[model samples]
Target: GFCSQSWTGLIAQLCSGISIVCWLCALTPQIYLNWRSGNTESLSLSFILIWLSGDICNLLGCFLTNQLPFQKFLGIYFCTFDSMLCFQLFYYRWWVKRRDSQLLRSMGFSDTSYHHHLAPSSSSPDGQPQAGTALLAANYNNPTAPDFFEGPAASGANDAFSLLDPSSASSDSPIIGRIIAWVCCGFYITSRLPQILKNHRRRSVEGLSLSMFIFALNGNLFYFSSIMLQSFVSPPGLLLASLPYIIGSVGTVLQDFTVFSQWFVFRR
Candidate 1:
């Protein structure tokens, strides 16, 4: 029994270590995708905001609950990374909008004027469309016309995933942030719902990064395993304490799976 317990403890610790490493790198795939595509429309701002809120809460909760020093550090790390992702979203949104506006301007088109200019007109005497009109008309008639000129204005995923720490509330903790932290926990749990629904509604997952979610899924699985193993190896009371974290990780995994399914089912 003693040897088995020790082995289990070791395995848990190993899982936890791997999870920590994963957390450190989890956002890389998504970041790369956003950078490569030069778009963040497929990502949900609400999802990012919710994840940020959760990270803030998790950080505060760590300090409030006096969790392990490493956990506190992890919270901080998560916040920093989450902030980068948020900034990426902001940057990409602004950049894409600006670029699209420039494209429209270069094309001598405005939102109001585009329809008017591109509308089909009677053919010229040569039985061909006018010089400038032909190209624009062809582009306008093409299925991908809107995508080229307008960009993916409506292609973001509407959900996000974040880890939550429930043990943040404590008698000694400040009331304000703690309350916010609790709210963050709720946000983290439900953040993925919108994205899933968005994918279902659109019947597409064009803007999402499969690698990002895959990394997230692996990270969460390991995180949950570590927590559950620790709880098992520790005293009975520890299990109850770890419940919230477990739920957070598990919920994230489920949502990730849902998103993955959408990717599989809706791939173009």
Candidate 2:
């Protein structure tokens, strides 16, 4: 429908475009944060990997169903971004530490010194307990301190898992596409839990970026709006066709709010 004849259609397209922009841009902040901090310890690897898995399903589902070109493009874009996040996690969690370990060995310091140098102190030189260190260092005396004490958590997770609109599986598509769409929904829903649990277990969201989830919330809201707007003016089947995407976006929104609440409860 042309803009002049169908305002709803026009608005729906506008919302969809906005959602694409938001979703594409959402992961960059977290990636940059990880790189800047020289670590991804604040984030959960499972969350990113699970989201990447969902994007793979979304892409395959889109291709199998012969969905819109842009939908397929979005799927590819999502997988690529998720891969980048995964690379950052590897670099920070494994590569960087390995590099440092090698350097420490070259300088004749053992692994014990490496750990000692990287560990944070529970108190400042002035003798006051640092706000986060005391709680994070509960196992400081143990030789095998847990990873959470390695550093403060990052300020965010990419709703990157939720970015793909798995709704590309229209009613006319094969049953496989619809099944994959639902599977993508499950991945998106399950992806957030690990990070939330990480935040809860640590009782801190110090380094996690609230902005990442904020962008995610906005993206999902607009994505859902576009689908609903289209459903209102299009045939009733349009609603059914878009069900998986609707559920994915809505479920992520509620989970995003849950993450937001965690921020308040655990903000340092």
Clashing pairs in 2: 42-154, 153-207, 154-207, 154-208, 155-207, 155-208, 155-209, 156-208, 156-209
- Model 1, range 1-268, lDDT digits (tens) per residue? 9898888778776765565555566667777766676656556676676676666665665555555455556667667767777777777666545565568889877855643443223332222111212100000000000011111100010001111223434544434333543455465567777667656665666556676676666766776665566555565654443444455666777777788787877763
Q: Write model 2 residue lDDT over 72-182, tens digit each, in one string.
A: 666677677778888877876677777887888999999777755554333323222122111010000000100111110000111111222344345445465557757
Model 1: lDDT to the true structure:
0.51
TM for candidate 1 is 0.70
Give Cα-based local distance difference scores for all models.
0.51, 0.58
RMSD (Å) per prediction: 13.6, 11.6
Report the C-alpha displacement of residue 242, candidate 1, in angstroms. Answer: 1.2
Models 1 onward score TM values of 0.70, 0.76
The window of 10 residues in a row where model 2 has the poorest summed lDDT is: 137-146
Error of 1 at 241 (Å): 1.0
**Candidate 1 clash total?**
6
Q: Which stretches of candidate 2 lie over 4 Å from their true place?
A: 1-5, 116-172
* Model number with the top TM-score: 2
Q: Model 1: residues >4 Å from true position, as ranges? A: 66-69, 99-107, 113-184
